[model samples]
Target: MSQARPTFQPVHRTAKMPKAHTEVDPLLDALGGRGRYQLLQYFVSKIYAFTAAFQLLNFVYVARNIPHTCGQPNNISDIFTAIDDDAFTINNSDIFYDKCSIRVVANISGDAETKQLPCLYGYSFDERKELSIISDMGIVCDRAPLKGLGQTLLIVGQGVGAAVLPIFSDRFGRRPVHLISHMIVLALGVGVAFSPTFTVFLVLRLILGLFQQGIVLTDATIGIEVFPTRYRKLVAFLSNIGWCTCHLFLPLVAYLLRDYSWRILQLGCCSVSAVIILQFFFLEESLRWLVANGNPKQIKRLLKKAARISRVDYQHVLDVYDSLHSGHEQLDTKKEQEGTLSKEQADALLTEPVVHTVDDETHSLLDFIKDKRLGLNVAVLWFIWFTDSMTYFGLYFTSDALAGDRFVNVVLLIVVQMPSSVAIYYLVDSIGRKKTCIFLHLITGFGLVGATVVRELMGNTGTGAIISTAFSCFGFFGIFGAFGALFFYTPEIFPTNIRNVGLGTSSAFSRFGGMLGPFAGLLSEYVTWAPGAVFTCCCLAATAMVIVLPETKGKELPQTLSDVKGWYVTTDDKRRMDSIAKDGDADETPGQHGL
Candidate 1:
C-alpha cells in the first residue's frame, strides 16, 4: 500500500476565475491618492476658509466702541470749555462719564441751579483711535444696544442660509452652488464696505452672512468628497490652517488700518474673494459626487485629467470603472454557462450594487430623524456642533476681557489654534476619530472649569488675570482642535447623497450657538463663572455623546444609505450577517469558491 501511494499522480484543476471590479476607494488609490490633483483641489477649496475667517472676526474690530463724551449743545457754543474746566458736572452720575446727558448751570431766577440736558448734538469721540461703527454712527449712549445688532443679524442670516442652501447643493451640485455663492459673497462684501448708512451696512452684513455660510458648506463638501479617506484628515487640517492663518493676520491688518475708516478694513477683507476668479478655471467637481449622481462621462473625464496630473495610467482607471459597472452581469453569465457556481452563490454574486439615484424623492432633515440609528448620530453631531460654536465664538467675543492687551490677547488666542490644528492632524489619524473627539472635549472641559475655579479664587488680580488667560488659551486649543476633527468626522458619517444636507443641518445648529455666543459673554455681568461653566458643561456633555459614535478613522467614506446603515449595528444584526455569510460560503460550489 505504501509503494502504491508513492506512485499515485496529483490531479490538475482547470477552472477559470472571474475578474473582480475594483471598489471606489481602491480605484481612487490606483489613480494615486494624495497626488498633485488632490493637492490642487485642497488648495483651491481652502482659499474660502481664509475669507470666511476674515469676515467672521473682522466685526470684532469694526464695531469697537471707544471712550466718548456728550457733544456741546448748539445753543451753548462754549459748553465744551466750561465742561473741560469742571464748571459742569455729569447729571447722570450712574454712568461713569454720563455719555448720554450732561449737567449745566442754569440761571433760574438769577440763581445758579444745575439741570440735566440730553446731547442734542453728536458725540465727541477720542481722536487717538480710528473710527468704528460705534463712533461713526453714534451707537453709544441710548443706542448702545444697537452695537451688536449687525453681528447678530449676520449670525442669524448664517443660520437661515445653513438651513436652506445645502438642499440646493444636494439637489443641483456642489460646484455650481459654491461658485455662485462665492460671487455673491464678493458682491455683498463690497456692497457692505460702500454702505451709506448703518442700516445699509447691517442689511449687507446679513446678506453677506448667507452667501458666506454657503461658501463654507460647499467648499468643505467639495474638499472632502474629492480626496480619498486617508487624506481627509489632511484636508480638514489644511482647511483649519487656512482659517488660522487669516485669523493670525487679521489683527495685524486691523492694527495697520487702525487709523483708517472701518470701511477700509471691510474692503480689504473682501479683496481676498478675488481668488474665486482663479477657481473658475482650475477647480474640478467632486469625483464621488459624479459617481453617486451617475455622471459617468464627467467621471471619466475627471479621472483622465487626474490620472494625467497624478501620472497614473488613465486606461487602467477607465478599465476599472468600466468593469465596476458591467462586470457582475457579464461574469455571472459566464459562470452560469460553465455551471460552476451553485444557485445561491450565483444569486449572491449577481446581486446589483447599490446605486444612489437623484430622483424626485426628497432627502431632508426629516429623513435623518426618521432613521433611528442615523437620527441618533445626527442628534449627537448637533450637540457637538452647538457646543463647539458656542465655545469658539464665546471665547473670541470675550477676548478683550482677558488680562493682556486686547490685540495681544486676540493674537495669542489665534496662535494657540495653529498647534491645536496640527495636533488634530496627527491625533485623528493615530488615536482615531471617536477617541480624539472625546480627548479634545475632556481637555476643553477641564481647561475651562480650571480657569473658572482660578478666576473665582483669585478674583481680578494681575496674577489671576494672567493665569486665567493661560487657561483660556488652553481651553481654546482643545475647542479649536475639536472643531477640525468635526469637519473630518461629519462628512465621513454621512453618505454622498446627503453629505451637504447633514453638514448643513449641523451648521445650522452651530449658527444657533453662534447667535448665543455674544450673549454668553453678557452672562459674566451677572455670574462671573457663568460663561466658563456653560462651556465646560457643554464640553463634558459632548464627550459623553462622542463615546456612543462609531469610530470612522481610516474607514472609507460611505457612498449610499446602505453603507451608513452597516456602520452602527446591534449584536443581533452582526450575528445575522455573519450567519448569512457563513451559509453562503457552505453553499458555494466546489472549485468556484472565493480565493
Candidate 2:
C-alpha cells in the first residue's frame, strides 16, 4: 500500500480561552497547515505590493499630462515643434510683428553680456498672424481644462462610489469588486490613450474616474480588514510611499518625453494598468470575509494555494492554526451559555441599528450629524482630508509653478518625501494616531502660513522665491504624516458594521476638497496671496477640530452598535449588553475600511 498521505486539519473560526471566551482567529487559521500557509502569507504580501503599484500609476500619469512649466505651450516651443537646423540657433527677432516677439537685449555668452546683436523669435507677415499673437504668448493651453474636468469627474465618481461601497462590498465580496473595478479603469484608460478629440477624451476620463474611486476604496477596505491589527500601520506606510513615488515618476516621465505628445503619457499609464490587471488572479478574497460567510473549507483551500505560491514550509502554518483552533474552542465553550447570533441573521444585522461588529449600523450620516460624538468625529475628519489634500496638491503644483527646470525640481520635491514616508512608518502607531495627526496638522499649517508671509515680505526675486518655496515644500512634507494617520484613524472612529459606509461617505465628501485643490492653484494666479491665507485658515480650523476628538490609542476594535451606543454599558455594572446576540442579532461579518 502507498504510504498514508499526511492528514490536513483546518483551524477553528473562533478563539477559545481555557476559562472563558476569546476573539476569533479565522484569518490566522485560514492559512491551514504550515508548509502551505507560509506560502499564502508571502502571496498576500505581493498582492498588496501590486495594489500600491497600480495606485502610483494614476498619480504619475496626472503629473505628466499637466506640465509644471510656468507658461503655456506654443508652436515654437510646444511638444510639436522640432529642430529646423542644427547649425542655426532659433532667433526670430528679425521676423517679429511686435506682439509675437521675444527681444534679445544682449548676447550673453560665457556668463558675460555683450552688445553684439539682438535677435527676436516669431514672424510679421503670415496667414496665422492673428492666431499667432495668442499662440506665441504660449497661450493655447491643452492640459488645464482637460485636467480640471478629469479631476472633477474623478471626485464626483469617488463621492458616488463611497456612497454605495458598503452595499457593494457586502453583495459582491471584496476581491471581486476590487478586480472588476480595476478592469473597468483599465478599459477606460485605453479610451483615454486613443481619444481623438478633447471632448470625447473628457467623457472617457470621467468614466475612468468612477472606476478609480471604487478600486481604491475597495482595496483599502480589504487591506484594513485582512491584515492583523499589529500590521495595519505597515499598510499605511506603504501606501504613502507608493503615493510619494508617483511624484518621482512624474518628473522622470516629464524629462524623458518633454518633446512627446500627451498621448504618449496616457499610453504609459495604460501599460501600467494592464500589468496590474494581470495580477488579479493572485488577489485573494479577504479571509475575514470567509469567516463571516461561514466557509471554513474555502478558506482552507485558499490558504493552501497561498502556501504553494509563497514557498513556505507547511508545518509552521499548521502550528499557528492549531493554536487558533484551541483558542476558538475555548471561546465558543464560554459563549455557549451566553449565546451567539446565527450566521445568516448576523449578516442582516450589519445594516441594522444597534448591532456593531461588522454588523452594526450604529449611525448613518444623518445620525452622525445628530449625535454629538459621531458628528464631531465626522466633522473633524472631513476638514482633515480637505486641508491635507489642498496643502499637498498646492505645494506640488506650486513647486512646478516656480521658476526652475520642472523635472528636476518636481523630482527633488518628491525625493524629500522619502524620509518623511519612512518617518511616518515609525511614528504613526508609536506616538498614537491622534497625536500624530494633530502634530502634523499644526506643523503644516504654520509652515504654509510662514511661507506665504516670507513670499509677500521678500518679493519674487529668484533667491526669495526659492527660499519661500522651500518653506512651502517643508510644510507640505508634514502633511503626509497627517494624511497617513487619517486613513488608519478614520475607520476606527465608527463602529464596525457601518464602518465602510461611514468612511466611504466621509472620503467622498473629503475628495471634493481634492477636486478643488487643483483649481485653487489655478485661482492663485489671479488672486495673488489670497489662496495661501485661505488655506492657512482652513488648516487652523482643521487642527482645532482634530484636537477635540477622542483618543482611540489603546482601545480594542468595537464589535457592535451596542459597543458604540453603550461603550459605558456593561454587565459587570450588573446590566447585560441586553444580549443583542439574539434579539438585536448584530452582524459579525467583520468590519471593512475605506480610503
lDDT of candidate 1 over 90-133, digit per residue (tens): 43222122577766664444467565657666777776333687
Measured against the true structure, the TM-scores of the candidates, in listed sequence, are 0.85, 0.68
Reference-based lDDT, each prediction: 0.75, 0.54
The runs of at least 3 residues in candidate 1 whose Cα sits more than 4 Å from the true structure, single-residue gaps closed, are 1-22, 74-98, 105-114, 128-130, 327-365, 399-406, 569-572, 579-595
Give each prediction's root-mean-square deviation over alpha carbons: 8.1, 13.0
RMSD in angstroms between candidate 1 and the native structure over all alpha carbons: 8.1
Model 1 whole-model lDDT (C-alpha atoms): 0.75
Report how far off residue 454 is in candidate 2 (Å): 0.5
